[model samples]
Target: MNSYSIPRFTMVLAGVLMGCLAMAAPDQPPVSAEKADERAGALLAKMTTEQKLELISGHNQFFIKGFPELGIPQLYMSDATQGVHIRPQLSNQLEKSVAFPAPIALAASWNPDLAYAYAKAVGEECRAGDVAVLLGPGMNIYRVSQCGRNFEYFGEDPYLIARMVERYVRGMQDTGTMATLKHFVANNTDHRRRTSNSIVDERTLHEIYLPGFKAGIDAGALAVMTSYNQVNGEWAGQSRAVITDLLRGQLGFKGLVMSDWTSVWDAEKIIKSGQDLEMPGKANIVKDAARLLAEGKVAMADVDRMARSILRTCIALGLHDRPVKDERFLAKFADHESVALQSAREGVVLLKNNGVLPLAPKGTGKILATGTFMEKLPRGGGSADVLGYNAVLLKQAIAETYGERVTFVAEPTDEQLKAADVVLLSTGTLDKEGADRPFALAKADEARVQRAVSLNPRTVVIVNSGGGIQMTDWNEQAAAVVYGWYPGQVGNRALVEVIAGLTNPSGRLPITIERRFKDSPGYGYVPAGEDVGKGLKRGEEMAKPVYPIEYKEGVFVGYRWYEAKKIAPLYAFGAGLSYTTYAYGQPVIAKANAKRGEAVTVTCTVHNTGKVAGAEVVQLYVRPAKAPVPRPEKELKGFAKIPLAPGEVKTVTFTLNPRDFAYWDVARHDWSVAPGRYQVLVGGASDRIAGEASVTLE
Candidate 1:
C-alpha cells in the first residue's frame, strides 16, 4: 500500500477553453451502475485492509510517493474561494485573499451568469497553480447577522443563494478543476463555531439552509465540505441525517464529502455518516479509528467502502494522470481575473441615486470624497477576511476623475467643505479582531460626517459595511446615500459609475440594514452560556438564556418587522434607488386558483418616467391572506430586474408556486400552504408597493 502504487484511469475527454462545455447529455448512458459497482469491488479486493484505511484516513501529499508504482497523481488543493492563495505556508501567504465583496454582494446583483463567469476565472487560477480541487464558493444562507462568516456567504433567501451557487459550481467544474461547496447544513453562525450547535427547526432546515447545498450538488459540484458547527444538536461533520440521509439519499450528491480543517471529533461517527476525508492534518482520533478497525470495534469493510468512495471521487475528478497544461490554456485562464473584477462590480448595490451622479456634466461640481473608512476599511473581520489584491478607494477614483476639482479632503477641512459643491463621504468598519461589532457608528466619523453635511447639505454618504448598522441619525442630512459593501477591485469604480450614473443601480438589500441591533430576529432570544446547551461559556451560567443582545425593539426582524408593526429603518430590504423613476402598474394574477406545483404569474407594466435610463428591480412579495400560523407580513417569493430607457415601458412578470408561498411547518416536518387567498404585491422597495393582486392556492 505504498502511496505511489495507486492506479489511474486515463480516458481522454473533450473540453472547452473557457471550461468543459456542459457534460454532453449522457452521450451513451454512463458506465452502467452495476458494472461500475463491480469495477469498484474488484479494485477494493486488490487493496489490503491497511491500505484501505490509509486511503480514507489521510491525504497523499503532491509529487511524493502518492502511488510510487501505481503512478496515480496525488491531487494538490489550494484555497481559491475568493482568490488564489499561491503560497503554501500561512505566514508566506498574502495578507489574505482579495477581500472581495461577499457572495451576498454577487447575489444582490441578481445575475447568475455573472457568478458563473466569475467562478470560471477562479477555475483558471486553480489549473494554473496545479491545484486539482479549489475549496470555494461557500454558498450558505445569511439567516442571521451574528454568523461570523456572514460576510463570506450568500444572503437571507434560499432561492437567491441556490440559483447563484449552482451557476458557480458549473463554472468552476467546467474549467477542468473541482469546486468544493462548503460548510454544509445549518452552519450559519460563527459564534463558538468549532463547538457551537445550531438548534434549527427541521422544516427551516429543508426550506432555507439545505436548498443551496442541494442545488450545488445537482449542478455537479465535485465535492461538499462538512461544516464546523452542529446541526440540530448533531455535529454537521458527523450527522447521518445531514450527510447520508438528506444529501446522498434525497439530493443525490455523488461527490466527495470532506470535513473542514480540524473539524472532525469522533472519527467513527463521521466515517459511518459518509464523510470521505479529514482535512488540514489527520487527527489523533483517526489513529484511534485505525486501532478500532484492527480490533472488532469497527468493520474492515467500512474502511474499504470509504477507500472506494475516495478513489471514485479521484477518478471522477480525472486526477489519475499528469495534468495536460498548454500555453494557450494558461492564456485563457488569465481572463478569469478580469471576470472577477467585473462580477464584483455588478454586485455593488447602489442604495441611492440622485441627479448628482455619472457627475452632472463630469466637472460641474467640485466633488469632495473623503474618509478614513475609505482609505483603510477592510471587509468583514476574522475568518472572512481575505488578504489579497482589491481595488482602490472611492477617494482615489473620484480624484482620478476630477483631478484638482475632486479634492479628497482626507479629514474634510473646514475650507474644503465650504468650497466643495458636493461632499461624498465613505465610512464603515474593517474586518477586525473583535468578537462582534458594537451597535453604533464610528463616533469620530459620525461627528465628521455631521460637520461636513452641515457645511454642505449637498453631501452624499457611502457606507462600506458588511452588515446592518446604525443609520437612523445623519440620514436626513445627506442628499443621497449608498451602501457599498466590500465590492472587490473594481468596487470604487463601480461605486463611481453608479453615483455618476454610468451603470444602473439594480442592487437591492440582501440583508435588512436595521436601525439598531435590538431590531434583529435573534435579539432577545439567542441563548448564551450553557442554558442554550452549547457555545463558549464565560464565568458561570445566568438565570435565564443570557441574551448579550437585549431586544429593545421586539418582533422587528427586517422589513417585515418594520412594516408589520409600523417601525421604520433607515432603509428596507429590497430597497435601492435608480437614477430614473419607475412607475408600477397594478399586478394582475393570471391564475386566481393554482395547484401545488402550478405557477402563479404576477404581471405588471413598468414605465421609466425619469430623465435617466436605468434598471428597476420589480420585487414580488407573497402574503398569507388568511394565516393559521404566524408569518412575515409578506415574504419575497420572486423578483425581476428590468432595464428601461427614459419613458420606456415594459411588462415584467414573476412566477411562484405553493412552495414559494408556503410556510415551513415543523409539526408536520414539511412545507405547508394554507389553501386560501394569497396576496402578490409587486414594487420597487418593501415600503413602496405599487401593484397588488390576490391568488388562491387550491
Candidate 2:
C-alpha cells in the first residue's frame, strides 16, 4: 500500500469506529502508588473482560480508553518533539506556536541548560494544548548521517546524547507533561525500517546504542515508545530480551512501554513480553488478544498487569484528578520567541572563515543573496515539522541589517556576480521521515555553487541540513561556511546576527563531515535501490530476503570510526570555528593515581586570546594505554562550554567516575575497568588536541 493510504485508514479507524466509546468523568481524586494498586485491583476485579480489553488498546489515534464509570480519565497524547502538532492538524482557525530549533541544532549548542529550557518551552505548549503525554525527545544515536530522523535525535556520541536526553526528560516532565523516549533500541536507518533487523553484539549494543535510553530512564521518564524495527532476531515491541530483560530488569525502568503507530505484528508476543500498549490499537490485535486469552495463549494476569501499569502512570501524573480537555489554552509565556532566537544563535556553527566575516552592515557594497534557501527555510519533515508563527526569512533579515544594499536573486550571471562585492549562496538538504536523504547535494545546486565561487572570489555558503553534508568539492574555494541545521521560526534573526557579527558563533559539529559516503562506517551496510525491494507487489514477498543490518563497525560509530581507520574527514567532529581565538593551559589532575571507585577531578584554564567575547567548548577525551579488548582510540568523556572576554581566563573542571573509565565486558555482563595507564587529552575538536596529561589507575 502507498504511504498516503495508511493515514487515511488510521483516521477512519480512529474517528468512526471508536467515536462512540464512553467519555471519561472529571474531578477524580489522584491516588498514591499504594492507593493506586488497591484502586487498580478493585477496578480490575469489577471490570468485565470486554472492558479490560478496551483499556489496553488505543481509543483513537491519540487517546487510550478509560473506565469513566469508575472515575478513571482517558489519557490524551500528541506528537510534540519540537512543539505541539495537534493545533496545526485541527480544521478550525490554526493556532500559532513557538517552534524552537531542531534536536540536532540543540545538540550543536552543547549546553544542557539550553536543552532543558528548549524542552520546557515545548512542554508548556503541550500543556496549553491539553496533551498529557508528549511523544518526544527521541534519543536515537546518530549512527549514519543520512538517517532521515537524525534531526530529531541528540547526536553521534552516546555520552553527549545521554547528558542531553537526561536533562530534556527532566525539563519536560517537570512541567506536568509525560516525556516519551522514543524509537527505542536501534531505530537508526529509515530504509525499510519496519522490516529490517538490527544485528549487533551484546557489548556494542550495551556501549554504543543503549546508553542514551539508559540515561533517559535514569532521568525518570514516564513512557518509552518501542521502535518499528527488530533487534537481534526478534521484533523490539515483542522481544522479551529487549522490552523486559534489558529495559525493565537491567535498567530498572518501571514506566509504560508503548509501540510505535501500528508496529505490533503479534498480540500474544507483545502482551507476554511486557509491552503495555499498542498504538492506534489495530482491530486484529484487539480481536486476537481476546481469542488468545480464551485459548490459554495469554493469561488474564497479563491483562490486569497492563491495565495497572497505565493506571499507575495516570495516577502519578495527576491525570486522574485533573483531566484536561481538547480545548485550546493560550500560551502564558511571552518570551518563548526570544528563547527560540537565542537557541538558534548559539547553535549555528561557523565552519570556515578567511578574515572576510564580521562584515560591516552599512559600508559593505551591494550584497547579492542567491539560491532557493534564501526565502525558503527547510525544517525537517514528519512529526518535527511545525508551521511556526511569524517565521522571519533570511532575505528580510539581511535587508534589515543592510537596507537597500542587499539584493535577492535565484540565479546570478557573471556580470551580476562581479558587480556585487560578495555572493551569499544559500543551499540545503531536504529530509523527511520514512526516507533517508542522499549524502550529496543536488547536482544543480552544486553546479550553481561552483559557478558562483568561480565568478566571485568572496563567496559565503550557508548550509541548512538536518545532519552532516558532503562539502569537499567547493569548501576550499568559499571564503566562509556556516552550518545552520534547521534553525526554526526565529532562525533567520540568528543567521543575520551571526553573519553580520552581531553575535559570535559558538555551535560545534555534532557529527563528522566525511569526504564521501563510502568513508562512513555504515556505508556498505546502507540500503541501495535494489536492496530495498522496491518492485515487489502489494502482498508479495521476496524469494531471497535480506533481513539483518550487521553493525560491523561495532563501537566505532562516528568519530571513533574515523580515528580507528585513520581516515581524514572533510571536517572533524566537534569542529567549529569562532570569530575569536582561545588558549588552553596544561590539564591538572587532582591525584595522579587513584584506586577504583574514587572520582578524579581534571581542571584546565582557558583564556580568550581574540578581541571579541565568545564561548568555547572545552572537550576532554580519554584513551586507555592498554586494553584487553578493542576500544575507540579516544572517547569523549566530559566537556564544559564557557564564555570569556578577551584576555580573560577561567578554570574549567570535570569529574570522572568509575563508569566513565570502564568498558562493557561481555563476560561479566557489566562495565569493567582494567588497571592501567590512561591518557587525558583536552582540545576544542577531536583532531585538534591542545593539551594532555597521563594518569594511572590502581
lDDT per model vs. reference: 0.65, 0.80
Question: How far in Å is the alpha carbon of 442 misplaced in model 2?
Answer: 1.5
The segments of candidate 1 whose C-alpha lies over 4 angstroms from its true place after superposition are 1-42, 58-68, 88-100, 321-329, 353-355, 380-391, 432-435, 524-566
Which segments of model 2 are wrong by more than 4 Å?
A: 1-35, 87-94, 325-329, 531-546
- lDDT of each residue in 37-122, candidate 2, tens digit only: 67667777888888777888887777878778988877777775777665444443226677788889989988776777677777
Per-residue lDDT for 556-642 in model 1, tens only? 335656677676666777777665678989999897788766778878999989776666778888888887766778877777767
TM-score attained by model 1: 0.85
Provide the global lDDT of candidate 1 against the true structure. 0.65
Q: Best by lDDT, which number?
A: 2
Deviation (Å) of 665 in candidate 2:
0.3
